[model samples]
Target chain A: MTDPDRVNALDERAAQWALRVDAATLNPQDQAELDAWLAADPRHAGAFARAMAANAYFDRAVALGVDRDIPEVATGIPEVSAEAPRVSERRVMSRRLWLGGAAGAMAASLLVALGLDRLAGSTSLTADKGTVRRTALEDGSAVTLNAGTEVSVAMKPLERRISMLAGEANFDVAKDASRPFIVEAGPVRIRVVGTSFLVHLSELGEVAVIVREGRVEVQAKGTAPALLTAGDRMTVPAQGAITREQLSVGEVDRLGLWQRGEMDLTGLTLGDAARQYARYSDRRIVIDDPQVAGLKVAGVFSTSDPKGFAQAAALAHGLRLTERDDAVVLSRK
Target chain B: MSFSRERAVWLGRNVFPHEAALRQWLSARTASAGLEVDDVVQETYAILASIERVDHIRNARTYMFEVAKSVVLQSLRRARIVTIDVQANAQFLEIPEDAPTPERVAADRQELSQVSAAIAALPDRCREVFTMRKIQGLSQRQVAEALGIAESTVEKHMVKALAILTNAIGRGGNVRNASSSVREQRDDSETSDRSRPRERA
Candidate 1:
């Protein structure tokens, strides 16, 4: 442990040391040892700071699944380009209204905003793609859509509002809990206060609401609003207002597969989850075997390919697959 | 009370609620946060789980604290990588057609990938703090509270991460202006990291 190997690893090690200090208050002698280590090398001091920054990254990434993004071109350490780091910091904190510990993304996003991300305004509904579009309506405060989704905004500064119209989105509605950030999709109207929530909508009219790290308030157009928590989920039928109930923590993760872009299934009917996973992929999974579709299959597969998804599913669930020209056929062996 | 139960109770009194936060902080602080904490905590618990003798008094809190710290220290000696620890194989194949290609683009890509893997393999705590400040955008105080350490600790972690990152950058030659090339590849690599489904996408 003393060799401390490479400098960056050493810094990372130092941060882990600090995490030890924080995980439980360290006794005096150990504390002194840490102090002595810090005092030994100027490089060590530098590594310690990097270690903190790294921990911050891990914390934020874990909280928000802030997938590690490597920009095509070097953008020189993602930092908010806004003139005032102060404003960006406040905006970043407020936006925590989105990612659970998703704050890391906020910083990257602000860099996008100040660097290239465009902001929005006035519309009660807004959908921003690959951008953190922030808007300050005369009456309501609003942020736009996530990575790939699209949305519209509307507002007269009196009745602030927006709609998910399409794709997954998170909202950090301004503090007028009375005038909530409501998304009117099909027949369901999702309302929320000074809180964070994730909404997934598609052309099929399917709407899903997931809460990662905080509380959320949900209500279909004709129904009353319900308060949900970290693992809570609400699904509205594509056509009907009839909403489903709460799901387990494991269930949210299953559904979250698309977001993570990695999924695996096994020993179950392809008819069950394969059809569900097709949502995230470019190609489609057609269940040719009506009965075999119900047959138990298993493996680990990337959600990106229904055809290839068989690998992961096969590995995990023991389902065999036969891929041929024209289409990938899955039959329970 | 049984030794293990007593230890749990003591941890309950000391850790709990913030236990997740502290662990989260520790995970953030340390590289391999997920694996390291689980391993050490498990070992500590296993040892406690097997013990027939319980330290009667003096607040099992100190014992638990000491053990966890010792675990962290012992953990410091363990090997790093949690994910598929492959060195960066960042080929230019997936780079969008519109991406910039300097004469040395491929060479630059190789260097950057090395730097990134080096960053990922950093120790738990330093990686945690480095991630927080560089990526998560938390202030020193927030990181301090969340990780359960001080602002000074957070600063120390950052300094360490930078030194390592800079040194790694230096190792690949031309460390001084390496980020210039880093700046060029900055905009589009987001989708390139882990889950690139060339298998489909």
Candidate 2:
């Protein structure tokens, strides 16, 4: 056989396999046959790949919006087009179609009459000091704002954007491949199709992202985009090199404890832990000595109880703990 | 390695649109070299499909062109009759940066229309089966039941439709004999049970 003939035969076989694979789940026998065929030759795999790619290419034909009735040519087939129930609409139905559907127009008008359209637009949400706030967006994604956190959410047609204005927020993003969920925190930007993650913008302008599920792509100014999967933590400092660490399951759970009013101070310095406490309570954990403040503290403590935390820290370090009217002060003995 | 469905979709969205330009560039470079453009394209797609991840690829068009160029170079090196001029030309070949310009966007829109036209050009039965399966988003069984034909017959028409469309659209709708080729395949009996269209009671 000629080279062209051989290539065409390979492509033909590849197309057959491609259709079967894409159309439905293949039986074990067919799967084994396909595996053997692909392994038999490099060109076979390549042709199969090309065929699969072509199959995917035509999937976008749905974007053409062709809803015309297909005419029966010669077979005199029954008119099924009129009564054929659409199993599923491949793409996300346009918002216009939803509003134009039965009773949807009435509901939309009622929403507009009630001034609820403003809620659909950009809305600023703030969690007050010592209070965590949880709110569900219209797209079904939920956000849990840490104490003293502020975020402005704008759900556009193409993208769902959240600007982290002040502090930390844990987002359980809904799966929408067409519309990416993007969170902009200071100089860092986090983009994901659908995933749960924590975005924290510290008081010092340091941005930290921790992925709880799926994957997220993070881009910081002047840095290459970093892809973070589950149990990955990345910290972008205000003016320093970015640091990425893979957390253990326990560590990820500890990081997410903020949503439950618990502070994980396992690896935090006394000074840093005190700062964390300040976000949750007005009563401060104050340490006057820099040496004492620099000492590391490790434990899970209630975020609202700074006095108890200071006492425990002082006891552990053999330091003096003085309880003032508004502040619990820890000092080096 | 095999290509995942997600990777295939990524190639379809990012790499497939640039096939016309890739073919044009390949033919221009390989015309004198006597290397088959289709052979190089298939090999390029093979390389693209075998890659583990696509997130690192910032520009897929540039990446695809570079892959095609490498395929051409590999073919030239392997050829028994070595041409010095073709080798040098392949080495100096520069791929234009496919920045998403207004013209590029218009070209992409034109590609979608080409897809519509390709579907329109399919044979009567083949077009109906493809439209129901792809455009109307129906299952093979649903399409068979709707058209009152055997499920296997529906599958056959789909395979033929896919082959014709893949060739037509992948090569910029230049397959003038697409319908004739499909008709030829339709006549060829692959399976005695499945090839003959059985009417559903």
Candidate 3:
């Protein structure tokens, strides 16, 4: 075959491979085949690269609504005729308008329902393991629940109260001076007129409060009420004295990373990181050796991929990885 | 150097838009440098794709132009018959400014129409499959179910669509006639296969 013909054949094969790669995860055999093909010749890699780039390029066609209507010819010249709007454009505009109106009407009705429901009794909000959920209260306050967390909200005409039953949650309390917003976790109570803060109830009955905005009055069982402003993190232990610390804006942002499905494992030991991953996924990252568990890990990792985290940890610490049916075990190599 | 989805997306958004300008620049020099413009483009893409990371590439347009220039230079060197004028032209090649010019802005706006035309130029079955997969965002399995064809057939159509569209857009969008001829030559067996009811249970 001629050089151009060979090149065309190579490109066609490359496109086939590129499509397969883009379509879905390749099996182990197909992956090996692709690896071999890529290593066979340098030009094969070049053609494959071009095909992959083209695959990415054409992905932008979705924005043009090309599926809905195809222009007869591209021509690179703008159409000059100003006739009635194209069918696709008209359809999109009407759909958007109808959606907007429907959403507005639904929200209005939802507010009325929530107001009546809140007046009746408390509402329990629970986020199961491996899920983060956000609930908007009738008072315009919003609460974001971390994985495996539960909070029950009881709002009266005079006061708004939330009971943090387990795990952690961030509260963005709306300003209602007449009705003070109160969050109760164990023996500690946080009262605020309007503020945003995170309340975490640990397994040992320790309540940690981090104020992101405004001011909150935190009162523990045996201590005087303490005032916490923005960037203040106060931890009240089950049977000890309360401790308070100031956090930088960056640190506060890092603390709230779980809301975005991320966990900053920086400065955390392998053992602690494993426990953190448990909140996001059932797949356990088990480290058998105490020495291996004590090894400090640093980096932000996705909360969803516990196995990936285990693998990286194994690689970094030079540990033997054992993938069991329900757990990823890491031991000293 | 390894391939990554993030890098592909970065190239698609940042670098691909400037292909026409790069092609125009290369066309002016390819005559004297003894280089094929398409070969240079493929090589440039290869280089971009193999890079370890794209975070360091602050300006994608300039980086792509420079990469294409180096591809031309590498080819000219391999040929071993580089003219002094061609060498001078390659060395003194002025990359377009980082900011989009008025013409570039207009061309950018016309890009959607260009894409529409490319899709329009595809064979009937090929176009439908491509549209459903790329535009309507359906999985190959879903498309097969919707079209009452085999999943393999959907994949074949996708592969053909990508090959044709890639060549057409790579040459700066005079793709209608070129794509149709190529489609006819390549899709004969697949066309017959598509006609048969090979539905999966």
Candidate 4:
């Protein structure tokens, strides 16, 4: 190879090593290989160090909110709600048409009225990372928010509306046909006369609405609305198709298990199950290999125990779970 | 206690002890990479503090370093490293320690605007793919399905977007002060890549 070509190859190898080491703790074999590569030449260490430092540049940007792409409206807060129409025209226009028009007016008034409620004068309730909160509204309805969940509630004599900005929540609505309980999350909204249901706004913008009792109508922009009754579930993928399915007895029992800090995965893919675990904990389960993510997993696991989940997933799928750095990485056995 | 408060307390008891070592370790690598030590430290703290169950951390010292190392590496892989000079653009990376003072908040607003401008400057396809991935939190498969493109193409666009932003931020907004050496090398490498014939995936 030419001198420059050789240098380029070395740099690429060093960058790969930097990525590998950062991905997870290397086993003895891998560690020895990395050590050998670093020891082979003085320039190798320099290249790896430089690459690591370069990586740090991106870290600083994220730390400073430079790479944050989600607009304020997507988060379901008031500051961006007023100006959201102009900015969200391209992406959220369809959902906004439903959320910001007449329905939007109802939501606005509901929030204002709820804001005036005697309890703490706060209309918003948020569950922090690794925490679940159960709150009772003034109107006798109860709502349970999972970890890392946020919802803004508004209530009026005519209607009760709750906007879930992120994460998951379970609602036990007070039967009042005069005041339909509407839960808006991302692109999907669930309107119920008075039913118990779970709304999970996934990180990928998908909305999963699981009904425990009664009936609720699930609506998404540009798609036909779906009517779900007791023991029914529907997942609306972002800007795509809506899938309706039945909730098995096991699934029904597992509904809102997060309230008890338990993760009941009934035939969920490893990746989705890991995401569910991540919702309840700060530690992330990184499927180092994509193939491993597709492995089917089912069990009742602890929400606070991602490591345990990883171990169980690994054991079940004939994979390996390596506890490394901040993330537990799962890989092929 | 609130989760954030409880987290803060847990982090104080477990992760805070290693702050000096982590700071020193990260600071030594920042100059060449064009990062502020404080920013790196803050990012490290944020990662550790966000962990849902601190009790699972068998060794706080090792976990803290692991979090810091992974944060740096993850940031790099997610960020695009172009030939921009970011050292002098200190205002963009300097965040107030923990609490944001009024002045610091104002500065952050300015920095956010600049970052938005940078995002706006991304190539059309790259920006779209990036928005879908980062903002909308769509998977590559989902992005491909939505855009009517191949998943590989989406990944490529994301890599390109990160490259553009990372390089731009690395330069820290001062176009003139940006280091030319890295840019020259990148230009050379890109030229070579383009000149080479396409290979099948």
Candidate 3 TM-score, C-alpha based: 0.43
lDDT tens digits, residue span A115-220, model 4: 1223333388898987666666776677878888899988876788899999999887878888888899997878998777889998899999988777899899
How high is the CA lDDT of each candidate model?
0.43, 0.66, 0.66, 0.55
lDDT of 2 at B108: 60
- Best of the candidates, DockQ: 3
What range of 10 consecutive residues in model 2 chain A has the weakest lDDT sum? A92-101
Kindly report which residue stretches of model 4 are placed more than 4 angstroms away from their true locations once superposed.
A1-122, A222-226, A265-276, A284-297, A310-333, B1-201
Query: How high is the TM-score of chain A in model 4?
Result: 0.52
List candidate 1 stretches off by more than 4 Å.
A1-4, A9-11, A14-151, A164-169, A172-180, A200-208, A213-217, A221-257, A260-268, A285-292, A295-302, A315-333, B1-201
Docking class of 3: incorrect
Better of 2 and 4 by TM-score: 2
- In candidate 3, stretches whose alpha carbon ends up further than 4 angstroms from where it belongs are A1-7, A71-333, B83-85, B89-92, B97-108, B177-201
Per-model DockQ against the true two-chain complex? 0.05, 0.10, 0.12, 0.03
- The better-scoring model by DockQ among 3 and 4 is 3
- Across A284-307, the per-residue lDDT of candidate 2 in tens digits comes to 888889999899876555575576
Using TM-score, give the best candidate's number. Answer: 2
